[model samples]
Target: MNPTPATSLSALREVLPQLAHPDGSPVRALVVDDEPMLADLVSMGLSLCGWEVRVAHAGRAAVEAARGFVPDVLVLDWMLPELDGIEVLAKVRSFRPGIPALMLTARDSVDDRIRGLAAGGDDYVTKPFSLEEVLIRLHRLVQRTGVMALDADELVVGDLSLNVRTREVSRGGEAIELTTTQFNLLQYLMENPRAVLSKAQILDHVWDYDFGGQANIVELYISYLRKRIDAGRVPMIHTVRGAGYVIRPA
Candidate 1:
């Protein structure tokens, strides 16, 4: 039997990990579909999963939204009026460049899929798709192109070095053993060194959107990180008092 909407939503939460702005804000998404009902449906579902969503009903409006929304992902319909999906994708690409896009359309043929992929759609879904399928595809797309898609294999902040390709972390040439969660959390901080990140921000980026744990969980992990990453070394992870946490040179 097909899953219920609530079941599908729960599956989506399992698939798409929470991604937050450095300040721990919800990850932004832009939905471009002339069909108001469909657009609103997607927006509402994603919003329930903690995404900050925006909608654009026209190709031009979609392109304009990309400029300011800076969406982490774009859900675009292929047969848009005025600009068509390909043209809108191309135009948005000039600005967003590597932003991931999922192309939606009634076109299910191989040729149509190829054209959409060539036009820079990261994923594609045919019309009459279930919301569950859309959410699953979206999760895979973000995993492929979002935070995990590093431009460089190695990340460096002061004496700290993280090899993205190797999943390795070291400080001052000494290897550091970190749990998978710790590793991901450290990578997030390393990516945005010197930025004071609040607990909400950390949870959003490092945990699942549906995470029900207390915010102090962030404090617990931060303490764990300090023990493994700092200990005797010159501390790089710092608390900003009323602010949050920052990773920078001592």
Candidate 2:
């Protein structure tokens, strides 16, 4: 039987019990594909599986949606209009590094997959994929990274402070409201302050097993963290070109 919208929602509801939630917050996802029908199917499948899903038909639009959607995961097609998936992924990495991104493409060549990963994609799914496989992969990815949980005791950086248990962040005694992922990435950076941590290293510590080998994701997330944590304040996180990252007082 073809899965209508109602049937899809019902199926998703049935699987809700098996899926885990992020401490009661809805799991958000962004799907980027030029093919509207394909994007809709993927969105419906994800929605049924208990994800809050949004779709973008082009790379530029995908970036715009991400600012508001703040998606925990991004399902990006390799080929896109205006900007290709790789370009979109690059732009996203500039803004939200460490957010897991799964690439969808009809191109199954090893070179293509390698290019995607090198560009900062966390995972790759070729076209004609099985819904079951995507769901399982996403679950594993989320579980491995633990990106949803924000109940840690505390995060500290050179006298700066973030109490995860209290959801409070302070630099020089001033409080900050960091989104869940930002907090996690910042915490990881603070924990390894002064170490030239690479993007891959950050992704491994911050995202799930489904994270691709691309390093740009780390760069993007660092920018997001810096904007919130260092914009008008002293810089705490610094990027080393051709190397990785280091955290220190500015």
| Clash tally, candidates in order | 1, 11
- How many times do residue backbones clash in model 2? 11
Error of 2 at 110 (Å): 1.3
Q: TM-score of each candidate? A: 0.59, 0.54
Q: lDDT for every model?
A: 0.80, 0.74
Residues 21-99, model 2: lDDT tens digits:
4345667889999999988987877777667899999989999999888887889998898899888877877788777
In candidate 1, stretches whose alpha carbon ends up further than 4 angstroms from where it belongs are 1-4, 148-250
In model 1, the Cα lDDT at residue 176 comes to 94
Q: lDDT by residue for model 1 over 1-250, one digit each (tens)?
A: 1333776687777655554544456767899999898898888778876778999999999999999888889999998888998898889889778778999888899999998998788889888888877876775565434233223666666567788789999887899989998998998898786678888788899985444666788889999999999999888899998888998754
RMSD of each: 12.1, 14.8
Alpha-carbon lDDT of model 1: 0.80
* Pairs clashing within candidate 1: 24-201
